[model samples]
Target: MHATTAIVTGKPGKARPRGGMTKKRPVDWLLLALVVVGAVLVIAPFYLVLVNSFKSPVDYATSGPLALPETLDFGGIIKFWERVNFPEKVWNSILIAGVVSVLAVVISMLNAFAIGIGRIRGRSWIVLLFLMANLLPQEALLYPLYFMFKSVGLYDNVWAVIIVFTVIQAAFGTYLLSSVYGTFPKEILEAASLDGASRWQILWRVVFPISRPTLSVLLIFFFIWTWNEFLIPLTFLASNANQTVPVAISVLQGDRLMDVTTTSASALLGIIPTLIFFLIFQRTLTRGITAGAVK
Candidate 1:
């Protein structure tokens, strides 16, 4: 009777679990949709501006906000370039931005390396001074700068704007690079030092390579800031030929403020280089900004 009465347990197989749920949450789809919508919203304005730049003034004025141009209007862009002395303005902007960015980065690297790596007695105080200098508003020093540049016969010169932009930008750049440098493993630096590597060698060979992303990011930022700077150039640069892109664009606004399309076209031209720069360094810039966010 015992052998005949075998028990038959009813346990679930691995294929048929107790709680079989294999669908994503509805909230996840909702969140993804929201993110897509937000991205579209953010991108739409830039798209409008860019597309509108290619439209004729009449087309731009009459067309729907999101409508594609029926035909390309290179004439408007050509007219804009001629009217604005676009090539000269672009050249001046490039030179100033390039020179200032390079000088700022070089100065920042040296200052950051010194303060970050060189065990100076008053390193903290030096860094604090830089922070304080960055805190000082440009407007507050404008008058003094104007007077000093005038005294030195540098007012209304490209060099004056270049020097001012470089100096002002260097403060922030130094602080940023120093923060990045501070995050580097000290043990690595010590090991390099023990291997008979000189300070310069370590900087060039060890630190610089690792810091490329941050440096590229800073370079792009400095270039954009310098290129778009208006007040400084307006104050120091008196000639159209010497004016940077921002100043040139501002002059366009003053001269043709009523002509919305021309002004918009000039604005678009001014923005092109910056957009190109971002397109070139987008990845490094993103990494640079997010470098220390996690750790």
Candidate 2:
């Protein structure tokens, strides 16, 4: 039986002497083509914007959308910066977004930690209330919030915007952090308790170390959301100096119309910080999602 099997296998090998080279399968080529097509579709718009940013206004309007620019021009960017008070706007945006992100994360972490790990009664009801708050539209609360802020003399202040953003962001952040904390092993927490560690120590030493990925993900998301927020800022911030980046960009549109080049430049500028942030925290974001999924 062994001899017969060997003879059958030998015949096929002898029939194809050069079988060492594995031929490209049809599916492999098809998948490669699909990937190439998808990449082109995703990249084309950015390429158009970048090329057009360097073109003259006439060229930008008349030239084919996909065409490369003949020469680079900084006129659009220069005009945008001068007209928009770009430096001051950037400073305001950074301060607002940075404070909001930090406050949101800190507040969410405390709320989630208390509800998840502390022996607190009515946790479920509290969590449910937060979830319900998220279900309500921001517009629905705007009138009440406006009156409250006005009464408190916070209407046009940065604090008003910060408080609103923090409150809005905390609900979702707490929900996500709570879900993540729930997946943590009770045994580990119990072990810490058995070791006579204080609650604060256990939280700082063990819980935080393990939850870094999730925290990083939440921080990035909150920063992006707060930085790009428009409606709340527009409604609450009455002064030009206090306007965030999104609000500033909206105000770029004049009575007649906006300058296409300047608008495009400002739009591009608005995305730069977010793009930089994503590049820095992309790995943490991936890890956070994967950790959550595994848990």
Candidate 3:
């Protein structure tokens, strides 16, 4: 008789014959296939962008987007770079995104502290109002903002875009941070109070340190969102010198007839800095997300 060995199933008195093979579940395969498909969908665009960026116009025309380039061509990239005055546009984007990220996070923290920790009357309603404000379409506010900024002589300036995004971003940040802060441990707050720590001291020294991970997540998000903003920046930053990367690209695309390769080069250039920024902060993002998930 063939000997049957037992396999422990991590339960008391629960064992299966080692000789028995576990049947592969159709559902597991299906889920894996779905994940692979999702990954492909997400990666395909970046692949296309990278591939075409190195192709010359002639090569692109001869061989479609999917085909490998005949040679590494820098001409298209160089042309796009010089045509748009790319460094200035990049600087504009970095400045706007960086400033907005910091300001928005600070504003959100203060707002969340009031609504969440303070437990003020009608705090729920206030949070709901902020959420409603976030839902308000930017299109509806465009003309009023335009008029206001123009009157204040802030139109066609990077600061105009910065200030606009700071408020807009802060609305969502406040809503999110409030929810996070609402669940903060009362014991900790009480202990801090007992220690004679002022509200200001508790906020800066205690709450801020504990919430740093979430704040870092918010900061990265705000920067990326502000970087990618197109409509408001295009409208407010009318001058070429003041335009962000997205605005510069749109302007170039609209004003000139760009071949596939050059257009791809422009897109690649536009996204590279943002990609680098994300890479640098990717560890922080991962740690923050993991930390936030734990209690």
Model 3, range 61-173, lDDT digits (tens) per residue?
A: 89999999999999889989999899999999999999999999999999999999999999999999999999999999899999999899998988988889999999999
Q: How accurate is candidate 3 locally (lDDT)?
A: 0.93
Candidate 1 on 1-295: residue-level lDDT in tens?
A: 2333333334433443348866668998999999999999998877776777677767876885477777777655676788779989889989999999999999999899988877567877888888898999778888999999999999888899889889988998888777777668999899999999999999999988878777887899999888888887888888777887888777777873336556657778888888898898898788877864544
User: By lDDT, is 1 or 2 better?
Assistant: 1
Model 3 clashing residue pairs (backbone): none
TM-score of each: 0.82, 0.85, 0.93
Show the lowest summed lDDT stretch of 10 residues, model 2: 10-19
CA shift at 65, candidate 2, in angstroms? Answer: 3.7
Compared with the true structure, model 2 gives a TM-score of 0.85
Error of 1 at 10 (Å): 11
**Candidate 2 total steric clashes:** 0
lDDT of 1 at 288: 74
| Model 3, residue 89: C-alpha shift (Å) | 0.5
Question: Against the true structure, whose TM-score is highest?
Answer: 3
